[model samples]
Target chain A: MTEALLHVDAIETFYGPIQAIRGVSLEVAPHQIVTVLGANGAGKTTVLRTVSGILDPEAGKVVFEGKDIAHMAPDQVMRMGICHVPEGREVFPFLTVRENLMMGSYTRRDSDGIAKDLALCFRYFPRLEERQHQRAGLLSGGEQQMLAISRALMGKPKLLLLDEPSLGLSPILVQQIFEIIRRINQEQGVAILLVEQNAHIALKTADYGYVLEVGRIVAEDHCATLLGRDDIKEFYLGQKEAGVRGQRRWKKRRLWN
Target chain B: MEDAARLLQLVVNGAAAGCIYGLIALGFVLIYKATEMVNFAQGDIMMLGGFVAYSAIAHWGVNYWVGGLIAIAATAAFGYALDAIVLRRVIGQPQFAVVMLTLGLGFIFRAAAGITWGYDSVGFDTPFTNKTVKLGGLILGDDNLSIIAGTVLLCGVLYLFFAKTRLGVAMQASSQNQLAAYYMGIPVRNVFSMIWAISAGVAAVAGILLSPVSMIDVNMGFLGIKAFAAAVIGGFGSIPGSVIGGVFVGIVEQLAGYYLPAGFQEVTSNIVLLGMLFIRPQGLFAERMGKRV
Candidate 1:
């Protein structure tokens, strides 16, 4: 593997007595869009949390840009160019949209560069420019997602780990959000590690995909290959099951015995 | 004419007292903004400030002005140490736990002061001139006038600090969202420690200033309760609000004592407090940034 931009090795995480992710290993290659597809409670969000240092791994290592950052603080991780847009888009509600954007560049001191980056954000979402002075809490779900993405962009991250970007979005907005993700990956050359529940769309957009079931990677393959596979199609890709395919899906095969 | 002059004197005296209460309330606000914990020990911390100055001036023979500065520094150091050793351990704890811990701390400080200074009340000599100024047949003590002027100066300085300085903005941001502030690379833990230090320092100044008016005693810490009332009258997090609240409480209390029946004065002060709360639950000048979530 050509030195991945972000690498995780056999990481385990827990919430008190309950083990969340057990020996989860994953990687995202430089400038590649990698998707981790899993059901709810499959530890998808936990993986991002561990890498971003919101949740520390009980075991294993997280390597970012050739540095071991398994135990680094969240801000320190961000400083090292890894921005996590957490699930639910936890925007500072009382702050103005402009103030929320300003907070994203809190670590930066270059006034000219910050101003330029802000202009760039407004260009990406003209809606943000119009609602710049309005409080962030008043924005619609789609607009908030745009602000979240733009806020992360202000951090100038080398890799963006997004959790459930399409969770509460409408279908049209979901498609638009995925398209924006693709454009960000292409135009900004920033690698993305996306964890999503919208399987069909995620599979379509991702360059490579990991099928995680119960905190373990059940399969890893090129997105096209995964999408075409008979077993994966029935299990995740929403293809019709059984009669025509006779695919030996693991869950079905196990049930027959 | 004599009665009118006396009324003017009482107003001036209450204003001076109100300024000190405002300064103390400022300390309360500073700590509350940073930690979201009410430091019940603020009064004891102020009492400790007075004792520190007393020891410096009496034993070390330091100039009174220099001794006052030393007291502030000593109290700040003590506050920092308290944060590092005691408060830091219980951070992110439940609100009740934090409140009880600080209350216990306040008691410990009071006990320590009792052990060291004994039960006797002692007078504090200040550097400010004690001349009485004549105005419209009323005499205002130079000390009282100085207290008012000093309070205005301190508020102005703090206003500039909060509005203009980078550190002040960072501190304000930290108060707004600590997790976000940490993620933004602000040293939040350090900010917490600094806030406590500054609070203790402010409390010490109030203690020293008040000592020349009312003799230093263990009972002085109870003034924190009145200061708490002041803070509530003004918005809790607002600097200007606290000052105005303190002065309003002080003047109202004085006016009630003079104009109302003997038993009614105490009841009237509380009545004013309740009236303010019933009308504006968030206080008259709180920032309108409250959120449902």
Candidate 2:
């Protein structure tokens, strides 16, 4: 494809003695929304951590913007325009929401451009503007998620790595979040590599998808094809109405006929 | 009227002494805020700073101010070197080990100073000799007045440094959340190193300032115990609190020494320190973070 913004080639990461990610290879093209769909403990978070340079990989390469940033420190990687919105939304609890957003642009020197982006963030999430002076820790769960995204946007990254943005949100809020993600993708021209356990929603939003199971990509295809596949239906998209796995498989085949 | 004048004199002396305590407390707060390590060796470091200035003035034939500047720079470099060599290795390990290591460092620094300067205390002469100002039939020494003025100037400069600069904000961010700061591209290690140097530099300034009032000795390192009390009084992380706490501690001690029995005077300050710990706990100005609702 059209010059991958982030290229991950067979990267393995270890936490002390335990190998969390084993030769995981992935890629996100410029301005594309790519989702890594997996269950919990499938090494999705580890992959993001490795690519973002929080944890160094034992082997393989992470090329961002054609630079080999495989073993670079997190700060150096962030300087190269890869912003990772980590799991649990680790927003600074003591800092004001405005201060948290300001911290996101810590590496940047363009004051005027940063101010403009901040205004754009307030436009994107008006709720943030209302609570601009409030401590980030006090924001509601959904609002905190919005603030995290807005803070990441403040970094003005070429690539955004999000780990389970829908983790603790209600269905309604999840839908709202997905819509905001869609807007961010379409408007910002920023590439997104989303790692999520919510496969149904992830497939709907992503242009391309990779199905991860036990630290390996079991399948990779266009999101529409993945959504349409019989195997995916059996494993992830089993219909609630069918109430039985085998029956749904037979029903899906019969429906096509 | 004579008793009131004596009391006034004690208060002024106490304030001057409190400025020194405040400077010591400020050093503790700076390093503690940046790294969460107490730097128990701070008093020894201050003593070391004084010795550096003493050597510079005596051997190098430097002016007292120039010697003071050189001493601050040298001690700052020493602090940075200590961080790089000793402190960096023990970081992310058991905090007790780090604490004990710093305590050991203090002893080592004191022992080194003792070897170099000998066991005897030495005078650190001020640029201004003992002069007096009279006001309403009361007298104020130039040294005491300068001590107050100097303390205010240092505090003001530090306040502006932390408030107006980008590096200061980055240091603040690092202190708040080291991991988040690192992830955000802030060089947290550099910030820690800078903080250690700054703390040492502040200690050097205190040492140089106090050298005029009191003779410099290895025993002066014990004054860190009192400064630690000052840090507690000010609310450990608060800069202004450190200064106020130091002054408060100094004044209380002076008043107790004057009013109470002769034997109780020496440890009277620790009683106020104990009261502060039991009553307020967080000091006057520290922000308490409750559970996030």
| DockQ for the candidates, in order | 0.34, 0.54
Model 2: native contacts recovered, as a fraction: 0.58
**For this target, which candidate reaches the highest lDDT against the unseen true structure?**
2
- Count: clashes, candidate 1: 0
Clashing pairs in 1: none
lDDT tens per residue, model 2, B22-101:
99999899888777787899999999999999899877889988998999999999888888777888777777987899
DockQ of 1: 0.34
**Which residue ranges in model 1 land beyond 4 Å of their true spot?**
A229-257, B1-12, B55-69, B115-119, B127-129, B235-240, B261-271, B274-293
Top-scoring candidate (TM-score): 2
Q: Write the per-residue lDDT of candidate 1 for residues A6-113, one digit (tens) a residue.
A: 999999999988888888888899899999998889999989989988788899999998899999988788899988787887676666788777777877888898
Colliding residue pairs in candidate 2: none
Candidate 2 per-residue C-alpha lDDT over A75-183 given as tens digits, one digit per residue, 9 for 90 to 100: 9998999888878787777778888888889889999989999999998889999999998878988888988888888899999889899989999999988998888
What DockQ class does candidate 2 belong to?
Answer: medium
Worst 10 residues of 1 chain B by lDDT: B177-186
